[model samples]
Target: MVAVAAALALGTNAGAQLYSTPAEVTANPLVKGFTVSGLTLSQGQTRVTLDLAGGRLVGLLVQGQGAQEVARGLVLAWGGEEKNVADLARSLGAEEVKAQARTAQGFAEDSEGTVLRLKVTGSGNAERWSAYTSLLIHPDSAFPTTANAEGNSKAPNVLRVFSDFQCPYCKRMWDTAHRTWAAQPNVYRVVHYHFPLEQHENAEPAAIASECAAAQGKFWPYADQLFSRVEDWVPQPNPTAKFVEYARALKLNVGTFQKCLTSAAPRTAVRAQYAAGLKVDVRGTPSVYLNGVQMQDYSDAEEAALIRTVTAASPSAAQVIEARLKALR
Candidate 1:
């Protein structure tokens, strides 16, 4: 059988608390799983260890006074039972959780404390149930954006791009952006927006999937895998199954990663992003906006010209306002 040793460390004013008792945490009797074996709690820090033998790993760190309290009582506290890994991941912390896939064990931290979920698909498909956790947990940073809340500060031209993981058009535009604007130091700024269609169930899942991976600071790698699967039809079984493969390929904590995807928070976040796109006039995937000016043709020449114009003008906030007003007229 596959064996996993999960460790978590908590910190506070008192110092660090370490939990490592194998008996305190129990593995799922039917299928391999994890439980808190030992716990160390203090006013400043808390720690727990999960002996995940034949189970997937998921984790989170909670900060702040409320999180500290939660961490103190987490081992004794019981949350709702969730079959999906994502739900279990989120239960640890009340934040949105999304699932990712990886081959091995992984860990995460937030406001509450640190958590480690392991994947113990030890020997057979039957043993994989260990990956589906009954416990709860809740689940960062990649790609610097030149655009601020008001829009591009350097480029002044905000390229809001609506993209899909399964769309070839989106891939083409992504490539073109890299060759054109993304290569420049501070020429043009691009803000990507996700708009996975209903026809492509996998596209939305993939978007959430990548976001879940982002929880572990692996957004780009997750994006790369999703984009790589653009040619194929990612459906319930296929996309879900393939995500596990991708996680395995990336050596991610398969259990915790998968749980993140099936959680509510990440799903809500994806939906919120999509709703925000509607307000910005995204009629279709691969939509482009240059300085708030929608680009009808995503051709190289048109995109390049727009880039050159914005870069040369280096429009100020007032100038950008004027330009946008002129377009309205």
Candidate 2:
């Protein structure tokens, strides 16, 4: 992918562009040549690299030193309510350049997890400004993985999916995509995270109920039931009793399941997972990631091919970054 490099973090939140699939970086016509790098976590000093049109090169996510050191491109996180950038010195790296640029236009997004973008059209000293390159960085996402999953735990391919119980698309993926994928022998393991949206009234309860099912080692089937029969419980103001009935139907210890569902444990677990989703910048339900990289949203045929090729024999994110860094040397 051609890297969409920004020279500096510019402008107020005019109209923050929220990036879902990395494909948007190139597909976008408004911002010329903006793109995301594939490598999620870069090992050594050199993590990410960007090549601009004018032979201007920069690192994206560099870490480490010496024998295996690599250079990463420079990037910054803009616009958050907290307005706090943790680990700025360590994560931003040694080579980060600070400069102000003229922002012609800009983007604004949600206060919690937002992707801010700014457009720069230089008119004055063009030669001096062309040298600096900047890339927007995603908040450090150490994905919170749960015991709920399918397939081999050690498989090379890993699909981390975030979903809400009341989400129809999540049901679509569960019935069509993940149900098929998870059944495959060695393809990939699916790790699920609960992301209960505020808009959905029963979503939080359903998430907690699913966690309760997880306690009894019935998360998958219980989840299937939730999606399969969303109409039954979601309409109700409080689905706690209905959730217990599902536990009974699944032949789980109905007593323990009831206790867990009502207790603080399941609620705490649900909130933690939701916060984790926010950390990874998950804005919508059914957010899926393959091998730590965002799978492109494309046509059914193209997406099928992408799913096959990327998961075929691709290295882990760390391994991929290391191999590329060494190649650069």
Cα deviation at 243, candidate 1, in Å, is 1.1
lDDT per prediction?
0.44, 0.53
lDDT of 2 by residue, 1-329 (tens): 00112212223221122211334322333223323345233322223232221121111222333111211112222211112222222322222221122332212122222222212233443311111122222322667747788898777667778899999888888888886777874867788899988999999999998998998899999998899899999899788888888888999999888788779988998899889878766788888766554443312445434434433433422333344334433
lDDT over C-alpha atoms for residue 270 of model 2: 84
Give the TM-score (vs. native) of candidate 1. 0.46
Per-residue accuracy of model 1 over 219-255 as CA lDDT, tens digit each: 6566767776665535445577777788778888889
TM-scores, all models, native as reference: 0.46, 0.59
State model 1's lDDT: 0.44
Sequence-dependent TM-score of model 2: 0.59
Clashes of each: 51, 19
